[model samples]
Target chain A: MRTLYHLALSPQSRLIRLVLGEKRMEVHLRAEPVWERRDEFLAINPAGEVPVLVEDDGSTIAGSQAIAEYLEECDDTIPLLPGTIADRAEIRRLVSWFDRKFDREVTDLLVGEKVMKRFLGIGEPSSSAIRAGHANLQIHLAYIAWLAERRTWLAGDKFSLADLAAAAHLSCVDYLGDVPWDHAPEAKEWYARVKSRPAFRSLLADAVPGLRPVGHYADLDF
Target chain B: MRTLYHLALSPQSRLIRLVLGEKRMEVHLRAEPVWERRDEFLAINPAGEVPVLVEDDGSTIAGSQAIAEYLEECDDTIPLLPGTIADRAEIRRLVSWFDRKFDREVTDLLVGEKVMKRFLGIGEPSSSAIRAGHANLQIHLAYIAWLAERRTWLAGDKFSLADLAAAAHLSCVDYLGDVPWDHAPEAKEWYARVKSRPAFRSLLADAVPGLRPVGHYADLDF
Candidate 1:
């Protein structure tokens, strides 16, 4: 069996988990507190990040994008990336948008300050940072709405890693009950379709011991 | 001819430039002030970032990783990524290491505070941020030395995009003369090898009008 070392609220980890499920690959999940700088985890991934996947053959794959591409190479069953070079580029561009742009502008500010800080004992959450996160979230949601209104999925007609990546980040923030779903109904509708997928079940069931997700987080109609 | 929208100091842009050069692809470089959020540039990449590549057919690829993968898919002549699935994973993992981890901890701090701030006219650079960038850089250099000491190349036997990504970030910072080369001899040796490649010529020759690079910036012997 393969194993995934991950953090519950981590968007990166969430993204990988979603990818694995989409690929229909079963993986034993272990919650790793990376901030502790565990030597074992560090040995697995020198970068000390979560969502490091170790195969039954003892081969290890680190980094979400690396793992995502590796899975695509290993199996083409559910094809998260669309065909054609141009379409693939668009999918990857959106993936980077969510992974890098959204992560920096939104997720880090919100989750880094609100959730991870407490877990790592890194002091109180900054109100200003949270405020900025919400502001950025609005802009990103609008962007998502813009895409959803036009394309069937975030990337195109096909359900791709672009949708997975965007949903993964949104899921983490939504868990904190921070997403302005009402303000961006089109984006909300798009997310609802994604959330109904079989891959998202495990994520909806995810619970962080002391911290609770939003009330409507698991609700399909929310 | 292909076109690359980039900023000379951007690590992501530098990575793409190196990859393009390594693949023997000719590109006309256009310096883009991304912070200005030029509508024309925004149309190319909504993320408002640089290193967006436009093909002769007008097909566009945004994001460094996307562009790199696109290049690999399009042409395998130089084959910056290795042969096997495992090898490719390792290369990409290291590429992510440099692009995300190294950039966040080092490049963004140093370059963001120094060069980008100047270009954006966003006030003075913070001394503390620069101090932290240098501090984080030492650890990264030591890690590079560790890898170089053990492997024939950063990701394994063949020179891959892993090396290009790492070297790209280092080169950008090195331009500002912030790299402490004396502390990591093995890393410097590896960089020297990368620096001597013909593909690196364009990057080495890069010069920003008002802010000049260090005297040894383009010198392969240094």
Candidate 2:
């Protein structure tokens, strides 16, 4: 069996888990304390980040985006990218938007301050950082609402990696109950559809030590 | 000709430019002041970042990684990525290394502080940030040297996107005269080879209006 080294609350790791689940691929998951910079783990990925996937063939794939693209190529039963080049570009664009932009503006601010700090014993969370994270969340939620109102999915008609990427970040934040879902009903409607998917089940079941998920985290109807 | 919306000093934009040059693709370059949040630009890329390519066929590709992947798929003549899946994963991982990790730890600190802050009129550059960037650069340079000593190219035998991505970021910092080449002689040698490529000519000749390249910026034998 393949093995995945990951942090439970990492959005990047969550994105891969969702992709793997959507494809019905099975892998043994190992929790990696990336902060410790373990020499053995560093041998696999010099960046010292999760999630890293080790194939049965002995090949290792590091980084979420790299793993996602690799999986899409290896398996075609469930395509995460669009068929056409133009449409695929749109999907990739949205994936970058959520993974990079949204993560920087919101997830890193909130999760970096709240969860990661605690895990690493990095001291108290900054009030300004949390406030900024919440403030940025509103803008992103509105953007999500805007996209949901126009397209069937975040990128287009197909539920591509863009949707998964966006949801992955949101799921991490949602675990902390940071998302103001009610502030963007259209986005929430779209998310509800995504949440109802079987791939999301594992993520919803994720419970970090000393950090409890929100009440509606696993609620399908929420 | 296709069009590329970019900033002259942006590493992400530079990576796309290098890829375009490698493919021998002609493109109209449009300098975008993303700080202004231009309405027209935002329509093309909600992320409002550079290196957005608009095709002659009216298809638009945003984000450097997305654009690079799209270009590779669309044009295979000068393949910047290796053929095998595992090889490709290694290439992608290194690309992510330079683009995400290096950019965050080094380029962003230097370029973001010195150039972008001035462009956006975001106040004076922090001395501490510049010191931090220089400190990080030494670590990355050593890593680059380590890889160069082992492989023909950063990824493997083939000169892949990994090389281009690393060069793109280093070029920006080099332009700022921040890279201490003597510290990592092997890495410097590798960079010289990447710089000598015909595709690197445009980047070598790049001169921002108020910001000039370093003395050896366009030097092939540097």
Candidate 3:
């Protein structure tokens, strides 16, 4: 069986998990405390980041994008990046948008301050960062609403990694009850559709020990 | 001819430029002052970032990774992501390592502070950030030297996108004359090899209007 080293609140880790579930691939999940910088884990991924996948043959694939591409190459039966070259480019562009831009502006601000800080014993969460996170979340959610209104899914007709990448970050933020879903109903509706998917089951059930998810986090109709 | 919207010092933009050059694709480079947040550019890329490639047909691909992957799919004649699935994963891992990690620690600090700040007219460059950037650069250079000593290229025997991504970031920092290449001879040797490639010529020749590159930035043998 394949194994995945991941963190509960890590959007990148959750993105891979969703990708695996969507692909119908079974993976043994192992929680890795990346902050400790474990030597053994570092040996597998020099980046010292989570969501590193180790195959049965001991082949290690690090980084979410790398793993996603590797999986797409290995088995394209359920392509998360489907369509023509242009279509695929749009999907990847959205994926990068969420992974990099969203992560920096919202996820890192909220999750890094709220969850990661507590786990790492870093100190109190900065209210300023949390405030900024909420403010930025509104802008992103509005963007999501715009995309949702235009396309069936985030990228296009099909449900793709773009949606997963987005939901991954939003889920992490949603876990903290930070997302103002009510204010952006269109984005909320799209997210509700994503939430009902079978692949999203495990993520909704994720409890980071001391940090319990918000009241409506697991609600499929959220 | 294809068109690429880019910033002079953006590592992401430079990565795509090198990728296009490697694939023997001719592109008309257009410098986009992303700080302006032009509504037209935002429509092409909601993220409003650089390295957005527009094809002759007006099909647009945004983001460095998306553009790189699209280029590879369009033409594999000079594949930058060569080899097996595992090998490709390794290459992508290194590419991400430099694109995300290296950029965050070094390029963003050095270039963002030194170049972007001046261009944006936000404020003066922080000496603290430049100090941290220099410190981080040494660690990354040492890591590069370690990898260079072990493999022919950063990812493996083949010179892949990993090398291009690393070089893209280092070249930006080098333009500021901040890279302490003398401290890491092996990394310097590896960079020299990348710098001498025909694909690197355009980048070497680039001179921002107000700022000049280091004396050795364009030199083949330094």
Alpha-carbon TM-score of each model against the true structure: 0.99, 0.98, 0.98
**Candidate 3 lDDT score relative to the true structure:** 0.94
Please name the candidate that would achieve the greatest lDDT relative to the true structure: 3
The list of candidate 1 runs beyond 4 A from truth reads none
Who is ahead in DockQ, 1 or 2? 1
What residue runs in model 3 are displaced by over 4 Å at the alpha carbon? none
DockQ measured for candidate 3: 0.93
Error of 2 at B56 (Å): 1.6
The global Cα lDDT (0 to 1) of model 2 is 0.92
Clashes of each: 0, 0, 0
Worst 10 residues of 1 chain B by lDDT: B74-83
Best by DockQ: 3
Per-residue error for A73 in candidate 1, Å, reads: 0.7
Give the higher-DockQ candidate: 2 or 3: 3
Candidate 1 predicts chain B with a TM-score of 0.98
DockQ of each: 0.86, 0.80, 0.93
